[model samples]
Target: MLMENLLRSKEYWSLIEHGVVTAPANATAEQRQAANESKLCDLKVKNYLFQSIDRAILDTILTRDTSKDIWDALRRKYQGSTKVKRAQLQALRREFEVLEMGESESVNEYFARTLAIANRMTSHGEIVQQITVVEKILRSMTERFNYVVCSIEESNDVTLMSIDELQSSLLLHEQRMKGKQSHSEEQALKVSNG
Candidate 1:
Protein backbone atom coordinates (compact mmCIF):
# COMPACT_ATOMS: atom_id res chain seq x y z
CA MET A 1 0.00 0.00 0.00
CA LEU A 2 2.81 2.33 0.91
CA MET A 3 4.54 1.55 -2.37
CA GLU A 4 1.35 2.23 -4.28
CA ASN A 5 0.91 5.56 -2.53
CA LEU A 6 4.48 6.52 -3.18
CA LEU A 7 4.20 5.67 -6.85
CA ARG A 8 0.94 7.57 -7.11
CA SER A 9 2.54 10.61 -5.53
CA LYS A 10 5.27 10.55 -8.17
CA GLU A 11 2.80 9.91 -11.03
CA TYR A 12 4.71 6.73 -11.76
CA TRP A 13 2.01 4.22 -10.83
CA SER A 14 1.14 3.77 -14.54
CA LEU A 15 4.33 1.81 -14.98
CA ILE A 16 3.13 -0.68 -12.39
CA GLU A 17 -0.51 -0.73 -13.50
CA HIS A 18 -0.05 -0.75 -17.33
CA GLY A 19 3.28 -2.49 -17.61
CA VAL A 20 6.20 -1.08 -19.62
CA VAL A 21 5.42 1.15 -22.60
CA THR A 22 6.94 -0.06 -25.83
CA ALA A 23 7.03 2.31 -28.79
CA PRO A 24 6.82 0.62 -32.18
CA ALA A 25 9.50 1.21 -34.88
CA ASN A 26 7.12 3.57 -36.78
CA ALA A 27 6.38 5.65 -33.65
CA THR A 28 7.15 9.39 -33.71
CA ALA A 29 9.89 11.05 -31.63
CA GLU A 30 7.29 12.21 -29.06
CA GLN A 31 6.04 8.64 -28.57
CA ARG A 32 9.60 7.31 -28.20
CA GLN A 33 10.39 10.05 -25.66
CA ALA A 34 7.32 9.13 -23.62
CA ALA A 35 8.33 5.49 -23.60
CA ASN A 36 11.87 6.42 -22.51
CA GLU A 37 10.44 8.53 -19.64
CA SER A 38 8.21 5.64 -18.56
CA LYS A 39 11.17 3.27 -18.56
CA LEU A 40 13.14 5.73 -16.43
CA CYS A 41 10.25 6.05 -13.98
CA ASP A 42 10.00 2.28 -13.81
CA LEU A 43 13.72 2.10 -12.94
CA LYS A 44 13.23 4.71 -10.24
CA VAL A 45 10.36 2.74 -8.80
CA LYS A 46 12.48 -0.45 -8.84
CA ASN A 47 15.29 1.42 -7.07
CA TYR A 48 12.88 2.60 -4.40
CA LEU A 49 11.75 -0.98 -3.87
CA PHE A 50 15.31 -2.22 -3.65
CA GLN A 51 16.22 0.40 -1.06
CA SER A 52 13.20 -0.34 1.09
CA ILE A 53 13.71 -4.10 1.51
CA ASP A 54 16.36 -6.03 3.46
CA ARG A 55 19.20 -8.01 1.87
CA ALA A 56 17.40 -11.36 2.18
CA ILE A 57 14.22 -10.23 0.38
CA LEU A 58 16.21 -8.24 -2.16
CA ASP A 59 18.18 -11.36 -3.06
CA THR A 60 14.97 -13.25 -3.74
CA ILE A 61 13.59 -10.53 -6.05
CA LEU A 62 16.92 -9.54 -7.63
CA THR A 63 16.03 -11.34 -10.83
CA ARG A 64 12.76 -9.42 -11.32
CA ASP A 65 13.12 -7.32 -14.51
CA THR A 66 10.65 -4.54 -13.71
CA SER A 67 9.05 -2.68 -10.79
CA LYS A 68 5.70 -4.36 -11.49
CA ASP A 69 7.33 -7.77 -11.36
CA ILE A 70 8.92 -6.96 -8.03
CA TRP A 71 5.68 -5.58 -6.66
CA ASP A 72 3.67 -8.63 -7.77
CA ALA A 73 6.30 -11.00 -6.37
CA LEU A 74 6.27 -9.31 -2.97
CA ARG A 75 2.48 -9.19 -2.91
CA ARG A 76 2.13 -12.86 -3.78
CA LYS A 77 4.75 -13.86 -1.21
CA TYR A 78 3.37 -11.80 1.68
CA GLN A 79 -0.35 -11.53 0.98
CA GLY A 80 -1.74 -14.73 2.46
CA SER A 81 -4.64 -16.70 0.99
CA THR A 82 -8.20 -15.42 1.40
CA LYS A 83 -8.91 -17.87 4.21
CA VAL A 84 -5.78 -16.83 6.13
CA LYS A 85 -6.68 -13.15 5.82
CA ARG A 86 -10.25 -13.83 6.95
CA ALA A 87 -9.07 -15.79 9.97
CA GLN A 88 -6.62 -13.03 10.93
CA LEU A 89 -9.31 -10.38 10.64
CA GLN A 90 -11.66 -12.49 12.77
CA ALA A 91 -9.02 -12.83 15.51
CA LEU A 92 -8.34 -9.09 15.44
CA ARG A 93 -12.05 -8.34 15.74
CA ARG A 94 -12.33 -10.61 18.76
CA GLU A 95 -9.30 -8.97 20.36
CA PHE A 96 -10.70 -5.50 19.73
CA GLU A 97 -14.03 -6.50 21.25
CA VAL A 98 -12.42 -7.90 24.38
CA LEU A 99 -9.86 -5.11 24.87
CA GLU A 100 -10.07 -3.24 28.21
CA MET A 101 -7.89 -0.80 30.05
CA GLY A 102 -5.85 -2.40 32.79
CA GLU A 103 -6.38 -1.12 36.35
CA SER A 104 -2.80 0.15 36.44
CA GLU A 105 -2.60 1.25 32.79
CA SER A 106 -2.45 4.98 32.06
CA VAL A 107 -4.75 6.64 29.53
CA ASN A 108 -2.00 6.93 26.91
CA GLU A 109 -0.94 3.30 27.31
CA TYR A 110 -4.49 2.07 26.85
CA PHE A 111 -4.98 4.29 23.79
CA ALA A 112 -1.74 3.04 22.27
CA ARG A 113 -2.71 -0.57 22.77
CA THR A 114 -6.18 -0.04 21.34
CA LEU A 115 -4.96 1.99 18.38
CA ALA A 116 -2.36 -0.64 17.54
CA ILE A 117 -5.02 -3.30 17.24
CA ALA A 118 -7.31 -0.92 15.38
CA ASN A 119 -4.57 -0.16 12.86
CA ARG A 120 -3.92 -3.85 12.32
CA MET A 121 -7.63 -4.41 11.73
CA THR A 122 -7.66 -1.56 9.23
CA SER A 123 -4.67 -2.99 7.38
CA HIS A 124 -6.60 -6.24 7.11
CA GLY A 125 -9.51 -4.36 5.41
CA GLU A 126 -11.66 -3.61 8.46
CA ILE A 127 -13.22 -0.17 8.17
CA VAL A 128 -12.45 1.14 11.65
CA GLN A 129 -13.70 4.68 12.13
CA GLN A 130 -12.53 7.28 14.61
CA ILE A 131 -15.94 7.31 16.28
CA THR A 132 -15.81 3.55 16.68
CA VAL A 133 -12.41 3.80 18.33
CA VAL A 134 -13.58 6.63 20.58
CA GLU A 135 -16.63 4.67 21.67
CA LYS A 136 -14.55 1.59 22.33
CA ILE A 137 -12.14 3.50 24.53
CA LEU A 138 -14.93 5.22 26.41
CA ARG A 139 -16.62 1.92 27.16
CA SER A 140 -13.49 -0.07 27.95
CA MET A 141 -11.81 2.31 30.37
CA THR A 142 -11.18 1.15 33.93
CA GLU A 143 -13.81 1.58 36.61
CA ARG A 144 -12.12 4.69 38.00
CA PHE A 145 -12.98 6.53 34.78
CA ASN A 146 -16.65 5.64 34.94
CA TYR A 147 -17.84 9.05 36.06
CA VAL A 148 -15.74 10.91 33.55
CA VAL A 149 -16.84 8.57 30.81
CA CYS A 150 -20.46 9.17 31.75
CA SER A 151 -19.93 12.92 31.76
CA ILE A 152 -18.26 12.81 28.37
CA GLU A 153 -20.98 10.67 26.85
CA GLU A 154 -23.75 12.83 28.29
CA SER A 155 -22.18 16.12 27.29
CA ASN A 156 -20.70 15.28 23.88
CA ASP A 157 -22.06 13.86 20.64
CA VAL A 158 -19.87 10.77 20.71
CA THR A 159 -20.54 10.07 17.04
CA LEU A 160 -18.81 13.32 16.13
CA MET A 161 -16.12 13.31 18.79
CA SER A 162 -12.60 12.68 17.46
CA ILE A 163 -10.18 10.25 19.02
CA ASP A 164 -7.84 13.12 19.84
CA GLU A 165 -10.52 15.08 21.68
CA LEU A 166 -11.54 12.04 23.72
CA GLN A 167 -7.91 11.25 24.45
CA SER A 168 -7.19 14.80 25.59
CA SER A 169 -10.22 14.85 27.87
CA LEU A 170 -9.29 11.52 29.45
CA LEU A 171 -5.64 12.52 29.78
CA LEU A 172 -6.62 15.71 31.64
CA HIS A 173 -8.77 13.70 34.02
CA GLU A 174 -6.01 11.14 34.53
CA GLN A 175 -3.53 13.89 35.39
CA ARG A 176 -5.90 15.42 37.92
CA MET A 177 -6.46 12.05 39.54
CA LYS A 178 -2.73 11.50 39.84
CA GLY A 179 -2.29 14.96 41.34
CA LYS A 180 -4.98 14.33 43.95
CA GLN A 181 -3.52 10.96 44.86
CA SER A 182 -0.05 12.46 45.33
CA HIS A 183 -1.48 15.28 47.42
CA SER A 184 -3.27 12.78 49.64
CA GLU A 185 -0.05 10.85 50.10
CA GLU A 186 1.76 14.06 51.03
CA GLN A 187 -0.88 14.93 53.59
CA ALA A 188 -0.61 11.49 55.21
CA LEU A 189 3.18 11.81 55.36
CA LYS A 190 2.89 15.25 57.01
CA VAL A 191 0.48 13.94 59.65
CA SER A 192 2.71 10.92 60.46
CA ASN A 193 5.82 13.15 60.71
CA GLY A 194 4.00 15.55 62.99
Candidate 2:
Protein backbone atom coordinates (compact mmCIF):
# COMPACT_ATOMS: atom_id res chain seq x y z
CA MET A 1 0.00 0.00 0.00
CA LEU A 2 2.81 2.42 0.83
CA MET A 3 4.54 1.63 -2.47
CA GLU A 4 1.30 2.19 -4.40
CA ASN A 5 0.77 5.54 -2.67
CA LEU A 6 4.31 6.62 -3.55
CA LEU A 7 3.85 5.53 -7.16
CA ARG A 8 0.62 7.54 -7.58
CA SER A 9 1.78 10.66 -5.75
CA LYS A 10 2.26 13.83 -7.83
CA GLU A 11 5.56 14.64 -6.13
CA TYR A 12 6.91 11.12 -6.69
CA TRP A 13 9.52 11.98 -9.31
CA SER A 14 11.09 8.84 -10.73
CA LEU A 15 13.04 7.23 -13.56
CA ILE A 16 9.85 6.54 -15.55
CA GLU A 17 10.70 8.52 -18.65
CA HIS A 18 7.67 10.50 -19.75
CA GLY A 19 7.83 12.11 -23.16
CA VAL A 20 8.77 15.79 -23.14
CA VAL A 21 5.76 17.97 -23.83
CA THR A 22 7.08 20.78 -25.97
CA ALA A 23 5.61 24.23 -26.48
CA PRO A 24 4.71 25.45 -30.00
CA ALA A 25 7.53 26.55 -32.31
CA ASN A 26 5.81 29.86 -33.02
CA ALA A 27 5.07 30.52 -29.35
CA THR A 28 7.54 33.39 -28.97
CA ALA A 29 8.45 34.93 -25.63
CA GLU A 30 6.63 38.14 -26.58
CA GLN A 31 3.43 36.27 -27.41
CA ARG A 32 3.64 34.32 -24.17
CA GLN A 33 4.16 37.53 -22.18
CA ALA A 34 1.18 39.12 -23.89
CA ALA A 35 -0.97 36.08 -23.24
CA ASN A 36 0.09 36.21 -19.62
CA GLU A 37 -0.76 39.91 -19.52
CA SER A 38 -4.33 39.34 -20.70
CA LYS A 39 -5.14 36.86 -17.99
CA LEU A 40 -8.76 35.73 -18.31
CA CYS A 41 -10.37 32.52 -17.12
CA ASP A 42 -9.55 29.34 -19.07
CA LEU A 43 -13.02 29.14 -20.60
CA LYS A 44 -12.94 32.80 -21.63
CA VAL A 45 -9.53 32.55 -23.27
CA LYS A 46 -10.54 29.41 -25.21
CA ASN A 47 -13.61 31.12 -26.67
CA TYR A 48 -11.61 34.26 -27.47
CA LEU A 49 -9.14 32.16 -29.45
CA PHE A 50 -11.93 30.53 -31.46
CA GLN A 51 -14.13 33.53 -32.25
CA SER A 52 -12.43 34.73 -35.44
CA ILE A 53 -11.78 31.25 -36.85
CA ASP A 54 -15.41 30.29 -36.32
CA ARG A 55 -16.71 33.44 -38.01
CA ALA A 56 -14.54 33.10 -41.10
CA ILE A 57 -15.29 29.40 -41.52
CA LEU A 58 -18.98 29.95 -40.99
CA ASP A 59 -19.04 32.63 -43.66
CA THR A 60 -17.30 30.39 -46.17
CA ILE A 61 -19.69 27.50 -45.48
CA LEU A 62 -22.77 29.70 -45.64
CA THR A 63 -21.72 30.71 -49.16
CA ARG A 64 -22.29 27.04 -50.15
CA ASP A 65 -25.35 25.90 -48.13
CA THR A 66 -27.71 27.03 -45.36
CA SER A 67 -29.21 24.03 -43.59
CA LYS A 68 -29.34 23.78 -39.77
CA ASP A 69 -29.50 19.97 -39.81
CA ILE A 70 -26.36 19.68 -41.94
CA TRP A 71 -24.54 22.22 -39.76
CA ASP A 72 -25.32 20.24 -36.59
CA ALA A 73 -24.12 17.02 -38.23
CA LEU A 74 -20.78 18.53 -39.26
CA ARG A 75 -20.03 19.99 -35.79
CA ARG A 76 -19.73 16.51 -34.22
CA LYS A 77 -17.21 15.41 -36.87
CA TYR A 78 -14.26 17.69 -35.87
CA GLN A 79 -15.02 18.32 -32.20
CA GLY A 80 -11.84 18.44 -30.05
CA SER A 81 -10.81 16.31 -27.06
CA THR A 82 -13.60 15.62 -24.54
CA LYS A 83 -11.41 16.36 -21.52
CA VAL A 84 -10.95 19.92 -20.24
CA LYS A 85 -9.19 22.39 -22.59
CA ARG A 86 -9.04 20.45 -25.87
CA ALA A 87 -12.69 19.64 -25.57
CA GLN A 88 -13.49 23.35 -25.35
CA LEU A 89 -11.35 24.14 -28.39
CA GLN A 90 -13.02 21.26 -30.23
CA ALA A 91 -16.42 22.68 -29.36
CA LEU A 92 -15.44 25.99 -30.96
CA ARG A 93 -13.93 24.21 -33.97
CA ARG A 94 -17.18 22.33 -34.41
CA GLU A 95 -19.11 25.57 -34.28
CA PHE A 96 -16.86 27.07 -36.94
CA GLU A 97 -17.06 23.94 -39.12
CA VAL A 98 -20.81 23.85 -38.78
CA LEU A 99 -21.04 27.43 -39.89
CA GLU A 100 -18.63 26.85 -42.75
CA MET A 101 -20.37 23.63 -43.86
CA GLY A 102 -23.70 25.42 -43.77
CA GLU A 103 -22.81 26.79 -47.21
CA SER A 104 -22.44 23.24 -48.56
CA GLU A 105 -18.68 23.42 -49.12
CA SER A 106 -17.11 20.04 -49.82
CA VAL A 107 -14.39 18.74 -47.47
CA ASN A 108 -11.74 19.77 -49.96
CA GLU A 109 -13.40 23.12 -50.35
CA TYR A 110 -13.47 23.47 -46.56
CA PHE A 111 -9.70 23.06 -46.32
CA ALA A 112 -9.23 25.43 -49.23
CA ARG A 113 -11.49 27.97 -47.60
CA THR A 114 -9.55 27.77 -44.33
CA LEU A 115 -6.27 28.20 -46.21
CA ALA A 116 -7.57 31.33 -47.82
CA ILE A 117 -8.72 32.65 -44.45
CA ALA A 118 -5.38 31.83 -42.85
CA ASN A 119 -3.51 33.62 -45.59
CA ARG A 120 -5.49 36.78 -44.87
CA MET A 121 -4.77 36.69 -41.13
CA THR A 122 -1.46 35.84 -39.41
CA SER A 123 -2.96 34.28 -36.25
CA HIS A 124 -5.74 32.19 -37.84
CA GLY A 125 -3.25 29.83 -39.44
CA GLU A 126 -0.92 29.51 -36.45
CA ILE A 127 -3.57 28.40 -33.93
CA VAL A 128 -4.56 25.40 -36.08
CA GLN A 129 -1.04 24.09 -36.73
CA GLN A 130 -0.67 21.77 -33.70
CA ILE A 131 -2.78 20.51 -30.82
CA THR A 132 0.18 21.01 -28.48
CA VAL A 133 0.03 24.78 -28.98
CA VAL A 134 -3.58 24.83 -27.89
CA GLU A 135 -2.76 22.82 -24.81
CA LYS A 136 0.18 25.03 -23.90
CA ILE A 137 -1.75 28.27 -24.09
CA LEU A 138 -4.75 26.80 -22.30
CA ARG A 139 -2.54 25.31 -19.62
CA SER A 140 -1.04 28.71 -18.81
CA MET A 141 -4.43 30.38 -18.67
CA THR A 142 -5.89 27.57 -16.53
CA GLU A 143 -2.96 27.57 -14.12
CA ARG A 144 -3.11 31.30 -13.41
CA PHE A 145 -6.90 31.28 -13.18
CA ASN A 146 -6.97 28.22 -10.90
CA TYR A 147 -4.21 29.58 -8.67
CA VAL A 148 -6.08 32.82 -8.16
CA VAL A 149 -9.39 31.02 -7.72
CA CYS A 150 -7.88 28.55 -5.28
CA SER A 151 -6.42 31.42 -3.27
CA ILE A 152 -9.93 32.78 -2.99
CA GLU A 153 -11.19 29.36 -1.80
CA GLU A 154 -8.99 29.02 1.28
CA SER A 155 -10.90 26.24 3.11
CA ASN A 156 -9.75 23.78 0.47
CA ASP A 157 -6.68 23.85 -1.81
CA VAL A 158 -4.65 25.26 1.07
CA THR A 159 -1.52 24.16 -0.75
CA LEU A 160 -1.99 27.08 -3.18
CA MET A 161 -0.67 30.56 -2.31
CA SER A 162 -2.79 32.53 0.11
CA ILE A 163 -5.34 35.11 -1.14
CA ASP A 164 -3.48 38.17 0.15
CA GLU A 165 -0.21 36.96 -1.30
CA LEU A 166 -1.71 36.24 -4.73
CA GLN A 167 -3.38 39.65 -4.70
CA SER A 168 0.05 41.27 -4.45
CA SER A 169 1.20 39.45 -7.61
CA LEU A 170 -2.07 40.33 -9.34
CA LEU A 171 -1.63 43.95 -8.32
CA LEU A 172 1.84 44.01 -9.82
CA HIS A 173 0.48 42.63 -13.10
CA GLU A 174 -2.26 45.26 -13.16
CA GLN A 175 0.20 48.01 -12.34
CA ARG A 176 2.53 46.93 -15.12
CA MET A 177 -0.35 46.92 -17.58
CA LYS A 178 -1.48 50.37 -16.51
CA GLY A 179 2.05 51.83 -16.40
CA LYS A 180 1.41 53.11 -12.90
CA GLN A 181 1.66 52.09 -9.28
CA SER A 182 -1.18 49.91 -8.01
CA HIS A 183 -4.28 51.80 -7.00
CA SER A 184 -7.56 50.92 -5.38
CA GLU A 185 -9.77 48.74 -7.56
CA GLU A 186 -12.40 46.25 -6.60
CA GLN A 187 -11.33 43.02 -8.23
CA ALA A 188 -13.61 40.11 -7.51
CA LEU A 189 -12.00 36.78 -6.75
CA LYS A 190 -13.55 33.61 -8.17
CA VAL A 191 -14.73 31.05 -5.65
CA SER A 192 -16.03 27.68 -6.78
CA ASN A 193 -18.02 25.43 -4.46
CA GLY A 194 -17.31 22.40 -6.59
Candidate 3:
Protein backbone atom coordinates (compact mmCIF):
# COMPACT_ATOMS: atom_id res chain seq x y z
CA MET A 1 0.00 0.00 0.00
CA LEU A 2 2.85 2.45 0.80
CA MET A 3 4.47 1.56 -2.49
CA GLU A 4 1.16 2.10 -4.25
CA ASN A 5 0.87 5.53 -2.65
CA LEU A 6 4.44 6.45 -3.60
CA LEU A 7 3.95 5.24 -7.15
CA ARG A 8 0.69 7.13 -7.48
CA SER A 9 2.28 10.34 -6.27
CA LYS A 10 5.43 9.85 -8.40
CA GLU A 11 7.54 10.02 -5.25
CA TYR A 12 9.09 6.56 -5.55
CA TRP A 13 12.41 7.97 -6.69
CA SER A 14 13.11 9.10 -3.14
CA LEU A 15 12.75 5.56 -1.83
CA ILE A 16 14.27 3.60 -4.71
CA GLU A 17 17.72 5.18 -4.35
CA HIS A 18 19.65 7.30 -1.92
CA GLY A 19 18.19 10.76 -2.38
CA VAL A 20 20.69 13.62 -2.44
CA VAL A 21 20.10 17.38 -2.52
CA THR A 22 21.12 18.29 -6.07
CA ALA A 23 21.22 22.11 -5.73
CA PRO A 24 24.42 23.58 -7.24
CA ALA A 25 26.24 26.57 -5.73
CA ASN A 26 26.20 28.52 -9.06
CA ALA A 27 22.47 27.81 -9.74
CA THR A 28 20.06 30.72 -10.27
CA ALA A 29 17.34 31.73 -7.77
CA GLU A 30 14.63 29.63 -9.57
CA GLN A 31 16.87 26.54 -9.69
CA ARG A 32 17.64 26.86 -5.96
CA GLN A 33 13.94 27.25 -5.20
CA ALA A 34 13.12 24.11 -7.21
CA ALA A 35 15.92 22.20 -5.49
CA ASN A 36 14.67 23.23 -2.06
CA GLU A 37 11.14 22.15 -3.01
CA SER A 38 12.43 18.78 -4.13
CA LYS A 39 14.32 18.31 -0.88
CA LEU A 40 11.26 19.26 1.15
CA CYS A 41 9.14 16.76 -0.81
CA ASP A 42 11.66 14.00 -0.12
CA LEU A 43 11.76 14.87 3.58
CA LYS A 44 7.96 14.84 3.75
CA VAL A 45 7.78 11.39 2.15
CA LYS A 46 10.52 10.07 4.40
CA ASN A 47 8.81 11.38 7.53
CA TYR A 48 5.48 9.89 6.47
CA LEU A 49 7.06 6.49 5.96
CA PHE A 50 8.81 6.72 9.31
CA GLN A 51 5.61 7.72 11.10
CA SER A 52 3.80 4.64 9.81
CA ILE A 53 6.14 2.32 11.67
CA ASP A 54 5.35 1.11 15.21
CA ARG A 55 6.87 2.88 18.19
CA ALA A 56 9.19 0.02 19.12
CA ILE A 57 10.51 -0.18 15.55
CA LEU A 58 10.60 3.58 15.35
CA ASP A 59 13.00 3.61 18.29
CA THR A 60 15.40 1.34 16.42
CA ILE A 61 15.57 3.70 13.44
CA LEU A 62 15.25 7.12 15.13
CA THR A 63 18.97 7.76 14.74
CA ARG A 64 18.94 6.96 11.01
CA ASP A 65 18.85 10.31 9.22
CA THR A 66 17.93 9.35 5.64
CA SER A 67 14.81 7.67 4.30
CA LYS A 68 16.85 5.18 2.28
CA ASP A 69 18.68 4.07 5.39
CA ILE A 70 15.43 3.55 7.28
CA TRP A 71 13.86 1.65 4.40
CA ASP A 72 16.89 -0.61 4.00
CA ALA A 73 17.04 -1.26 7.71
CA LEU A 74 13.39 -2.30 7.86
CA ARG A 75 13.61 -4.43 4.77
CA ARG A 76 16.74 -6.19 5.99
CA LYS A 77 15.25 -6.90 9.38
CA TYR A 78 12.03 -8.33 7.95
CA GLN A 79 13.19 -9.92 4.71
CA GLY A 80 16.38 -11.46 6.09
CA SER A 81 19.21 -12.94 4.06
CA THR A 82 18.90 -15.32 1.11
CA LYS A 83 19.98 -18.22 3.29
CA VAL A 84 17.35 -17.39 5.87
CA LYS A 85 14.66 -17.21 3.19
CA ARG A 86 15.77 -20.57 1.80
CA ALA A 87 15.59 -22.17 5.23
CA GLN A 88 12.14 -20.70 5.87
CA LEU A 89 10.91 -21.98 2.51
CA GLN A 90 12.34 -25.43 3.18
CA ALA A 91 10.57 -25.62 6.53
CA LEU A 92 7.28 -24.56 4.96
CA ARG A 93 7.74 -27.20 2.25
CA ARG A 94 8.34 -29.88 4.84
CA GLU A 95 5.26 -28.81 6.74
CA PHE A 96 3.19 -28.87 3.57
CA GLU A 97 4.51 -32.25 2.45
CA VAL A 98 3.72 -33.84 5.82
CA LEU A 99 0.32 -32.19 6.22
CA GLU A 100 -2.65 -34.52 6.78
CA MET A 101 -6.26 -34.01 7.71
CA GLY A 102 -7.08 -35.16 11.24
CA GLU A 103 -9.75 -37.82 11.47
CA SER A 104 -12.31 -35.46 13.06
CA GLU A 105 -11.18 -32.33 11.20
CA SER A 106 -13.63 -30.68 8.83
CA VAL A 107 -12.83 -29.92 5.20
CA ASN A 108 -12.68 -26.21 6.02
CA GLU A 109 -10.15 -26.79 8.78
CA TYR A 110 -7.97 -28.95 6.56
CA PHE A 111 -8.10 -26.46 3.70
CA ALA A 112 -7.22 -23.63 6.06
CA ARG A 113 -4.23 -25.54 7.39
CA THR A 114 -3.01 -26.41 3.91
CA LEU A 115 -3.46 -22.89 2.62
CA ALA A 116 -1.60 -21.40 5.56
CA ILE A 117 1.50 -23.41 4.80
CA ALA A 118 1.11 -22.66 1.08
CA ASN A 119 0.86 -18.94 1.80
CA ARG A 120 3.94 -19.01 3.99
CA MET A 121 5.79 -20.81 1.24
CA THR A 122 4.73 -18.08 -1.18
CA SER A 123 5.91 -15.39 1.22
CA HIS A 124 9.29 -17.08 1.30
CA GLY A 125 9.51 -16.86 -2.51
CA GLU A 126 8.32 -20.36 -3.35
CA ILE A 127 5.55 -20.96 -5.84
CA VAL A 128 2.70 -23.05 -4.42
CA GLN A 129 1.13 -24.18 -7.67
CA GLN A 130 -2.57 -25.08 -7.62
CA ILE A 131 -1.89 -28.52 -9.06
CA THR A 132 0.55 -29.25 -6.25
CA VAL A 133 -1.94 -28.11 -3.64
CA VAL A 134 -4.74 -30.18 -5.23
CA GLU A 135 -2.61 -33.31 -5.34
CA LYS A 136 -1.62 -32.87 -1.71
CA ILE A 137 -5.26 -32.52 -0.67
CA LEU A 138 -6.32 -35.51 -2.72
CA ARG A 139 -3.70 -37.71 -1.09
CA SER A 140 -3.80 -36.43 2.47
CA MET A 141 -7.48 -36.22 3.38
CA THR A 142 -8.99 -38.66 5.89
CA GLU A 143 -10.36 -42.01 4.72
CA ARG A 144 -13.95 -40.69 4.82
CA PHE A 145 -13.18 -38.68 1.69
CA ASN A 146 -11.74 -41.62 -0.28
CA TYR A 147 -14.76 -42.32 -2.41
CA VAL A 148 -15.24 -38.72 -3.44
CA VAL A 149 -11.53 -38.35 -3.97
CA CYS A 150 -11.55 -41.40 -6.18
CA SER A 151 -14.55 -40.10 -8.10
CA ILE A 152 -12.82 -36.80 -8.61
CA GLU A 153 -9.57 -38.42 -9.65
CA GLU A 154 -11.37 -40.62 -12.13
CA SER A 155 -13.73 -38.05 -13.61
CA ASN A 156 -11.72 -34.83 -13.37
CA ASP A 157 -8.13 -33.95 -14.03
CA VAL A 158 -6.75 -33.25 -10.57
CA THR A 159 -3.81 -31.47 -12.21
CA LEU A 160 -6.14 -28.93 -13.78
CA MET A 161 -8.67 -28.66 -10.94
CA SER A 162 -8.57 -25.57 -8.77
CA ILE A 163 -8.23 -25.93 -5.01
CA ASP A 164 -11.63 -24.26 -4.54
CA GLU A 165 -13.31 -26.87 -6.76
CA LEU A 166 -11.75 -29.76 -4.87
CA GLN A 167 -12.55 -28.13 -1.54
CA SER A 168 -16.19 -27.60 -2.53
CA SER A 169 -16.56 -31.21 -3.63
CA LEU A 170 -15.03 -32.49 -0.41
CA LEU A 171 -17.09 -30.12 1.71
CA LEU A 172 -20.28 -31.31 0.00
CA HIS A 173 -19.33 -34.91 0.64
CA GLU A 174 -18.52 -34.12 4.25
CA GLN A 175 -21.87 -32.41 4.76
CA ARG A 176 -23.72 -35.36 3.17
CA MET A 177 -21.85 -37.84 5.37
CA LYS A 178 -22.70 -35.80 8.46
CA GLY A 179 -26.37 -35.67 7.42
CA LYS A 180 -26.49 -39.43 6.91
CA GLN A 181 -24.97 -40.04 10.33
CA SER A 182 -27.53 -37.73 11.95
CA HIS A 183 -30.39 -39.42 10.11
CA SER A 184 -29.16 -42.87 11.15
CA GLU A 185 -28.87 -41.76 14.77
CA GLU A 186 -32.47 -40.41 14.70
CA GLN A 187 -33.75 -43.71 13.27
CA ALA A 188 -31.94 -45.70 15.95
CA LEU A 189 -33.35 -43.44 18.68
CA LYS A 190 -36.90 -43.85 17.29
CA VAL A 191 -36.57 -47.65 17.27
CA SER A 192 -35.37 -47.72 20.86
CA ASN A 193 -38.07 -45.29 22.10
CA GLY A 194 -40.86 -47.06 20.21
lDDT of 2 by residue, 80-116 (tens): 3345445455555654443332233333343344444
Say which candidate scores most in lDDT.
1
lDDT of 2: 0.37
lDDT of 3 by residue, 97-134 (tens): 99999998999999999998998888778888999999
- Show model 3 residue runs off by greater than 4 Å: 1-54
| Comparison by lDDT, 1 against 2, better one | 1
lDDT of 3: 0.84
TM-score of 2: 0.18
**Model 2 worst lDDT window (10 residues):** 12-21
Number of the top candidate by TM-score? 1
Cα lDDT computed for each candidate against the true fold? 0.93, 0.37, 0.84
Count residue pairs with overlapping backbones in model 2. Answer: 8
User: Any runs in candidate 2 off by more than 4 Å, and if so which?
Assistant: 1-56, 63-67, 70-74, 80-194
TM for every model, in the order presented, reads 0.92, 0.18, 0.77
Residue 48, model 1: lDDT of 91
Q: lDDT rank, highest first?
A: 1, 3, 2
> For model 1, how does the per-residue alpha-carbon lDDT over 1-194 read when each residue is reduced to its tens digit?
77789889998888888878989999999999988988888899999999999999999999999999998889878878888899999999999999999999999999999999999999899999999999999989999999999999999999999999999999999999999999999999999999
